[model samples]
Target: MARTSNMLKAAMALVLCYPLAIAESEDDFWEYDVRVSEGYCVYRNKTFAAYVDYTLEEPCEKWNCYPDDQMVLEQHCPPPPGYEIPSNASKDAWPYCCSNSTSS
Candidate 1:
């Protein structure tokens, strides 16, 4: 009886931890770098004017530059639950082709 109880506890713990694991994995996919000097933001050896919004195609991220020499980063997260990607979808396209529709 104790063995069965322990096994149930173990299963309950795993179920509770599953969402945390998913959240961590999603957070790990993003990369951030911010450098501000002379009222501008520098990224990848390039300088961006203040109050400008720019995008990076390689990783499909959007960056917003603020006059205070601060930058905000936003990227496409994983598709919603139950969404399905077509077989011929292009991974290089990122958010655009990452997912299509829910499995039916």
Candidate 2:
């Protein structure tokens, strides 16, 4: 009889504490990192320049090491609109127009 009573008490304690344990296991926050690059590349007759697209992923991957689309370069320029060249713009002028605040 004593063994059965102890077993029942243990079962009751587990049942009562299960909800609190599960709630504590829930994730409370998420973290991410933003990456930027000196957006420059040449394609076709014109030079392409602008901040690259912003992306979110697990925090483990370091900058430039992650896949192309996963880096966030949106602070200087946003995406879905790749930077376009202005009319009469010289290739040399491309750097001046598209350059970030600091020079590399």
Candidate 3:
């Protein structure tokens, strides 16, 4: 009887935790970004909103600066949708890294 009770308990535990695991996968990569350090949202030309990094300085996220124009790109992680690492992107103003608010 004890053995049967333990098995039933184990099965119940797995069943209860299954949904929680599924919900976690919904966001997947983006989910973790939310936890990154909070900062102001950088706007891309007062229209499009660019991506956010967990830092205070410009090129807030991990990126490579193009000494000339001063543009940056996701150095470590792959570029997000629409954010293409440009070969000659102007870093004069906001809207950097070819990224916007819609990103991630």
Candidate closest to the true structure, highest TM-score? 1
* lDDT per residue (tens digit) for residues 6-86 in model 2: 445533543353333223222221222323244433222223333322222221111111122222111221111233434
Please say which candidate is ahead in lDDT: 1 or 3.
Answer: 1
Instruction: List, residue by residue over 55-81, the lDDT tens digit for candidate 3.
Output: 212433332222122222232222333
Clash count of each predicted structure: 0, 0, 4
Descending-lDDT candidate ranking = 1, 3, 2
> Candidate 2: which stretches are off by over 4 Å?
20-104
Candidate 2 vs candidate 3, lDDT winner: 3
Give model 2 RMSD, 1 decimal.
22.8
- Provide the overall lDDT of each model, using Cα atoms, as 2-decimal numbers: 0.46, 0.28, 0.31
Q: What is the lDDT of residue 68 in candidate 3?
A: 20
Worst 10 residues of 3 by lDDT: 28-37
Off by over 4 Å in 3: 20-104
Q: Sort the predicted structures by TM-score, highest score first.
A: 1, 3, 2
